[model samples]
Target: MSNITWSFADRVVAITGSAIGMGEGAVETFAAAGASVYGLDVDAKRGRAVAERTGSTFVECDVTSSAAVLAAFEQIATRHQRLDVLINNAGGFWEQNTTESISEIEWDHVIDLNLKGVFLCARHAIPLLRQSSAGRIITISSLAGQTAIYQSSPAYAAAKAGVLSLTRVLASELGADGITSNAIAPSAVLTERIKVVRSAEERAATAASIPLGRYGGVDDLVTWMMFLASEEGGYMTGETIAVNGGRFMS
Candidate 1:
């Protein structure tokens, strides 16, 4: 986040869950790089604020709804005609619980938002992405996807694992079309949701355990995303880059 410079002058980038947290960070990052950024989220108020700050387009879209996703892409296509990058950053953890304690409703809710949402966005954006010369699809996963090294809802872990599989599948299927798909698995990032869910003492303890001596931040994830979307990342596909500061290595 220092002396960083990357120019994506005419690239069109779309980010899900762009209202806050890592998604918002991405919007700001791409906008600064001169990309035509589009922010998608169900929270219109916050999304609009992000758009105002970054000068990106804000679209009200619920990632879980196929119709909403389709309409949003239609709007993007109408404006940009082509999409260079798609970041599936919209995800959530329903609650902290084990299999026996987790309800079927909770499982479905978590899976739908975290995993299904990624599928829906990719499904709609593939056509637009194919129109670009260097298309990049970056999905935000979690260290929980690799191993059970952190305390998270069982549903969260399962959904993120599914995301990793989906990313690889997309890379394999879309490679012939000159598209690249990748996943970023981060651990203990300090986003708005994390600040609300974990206490200060808990966060300090978690940071102490990390080999980097601090928890990851939104900028760290965004920087990786920028690289994956850059021309230098053209040859990369079906890879999962871990950004946990050595919390879990696989």
Candidate 2:
């Protein structure tokens, strides 16, 4: 039998969007498994509180801004000396009356936060991640990244699609550096924002659509993340694990 214990005893993991929901859960889980976790979020209060509770570090960061992302990465180096994992989970939805009604500013914000933020964070975190013996970059894509779904807006869909593309490119490009890039495409999950957006009936309808007959929880996604971040996942790169409860399968 395999001893599937995820112990990052001397490892550092930097998770963006780590203030709440999936990010917050991951912080707690990873920390419990012996990882030195660091969180980056625009919401400093929630971020710091979560970090304190989990014994992780929190850094105030607006992922959409390159200046903030770079500064956060610099601080990570100073504190932990090296970084092992980068979870690019910062994203949001934006649209106007329709695709036609979307302003240039609106379009930019969605793309910047969803797509550009991942690029910026990975770019800045690369130096430190590369220093680790087994470096992993895990980006959070969605069912929107895989196929057209009515859940997210147009810009969010496009940016998440770009995240998948970036994952493949980086995996190939960074292979020699011993750095692996992968993505997780999660289906509808019952998170705080999701609870507000989806009613009980609507959620039931969506869950019924999945072959698994349920929504994939945060833990479902975290299990894959833990796998990809582990040393055993060295050869498993450039892949996107879908945690949609078989919502849309290939």
- lDDT digits (tens) for residues 67-88 of candidate 1: 9999999999998898999999
Q: What lDDT score goes with residue 21 in model 1?
A: 93
Q: Pairs clashing in candidate 2?
A: none
In candidate 2, what are the lDDT values of residues 100-183, reduced to their tens digit?
667778888899999999999999998998798989999999998899887567788888999999999999988999999999
Candidate 1 steric clashes? 0
Clashes of each: 0, 0
Please give the RMSD of candidate 1 to the true structure.
1.0
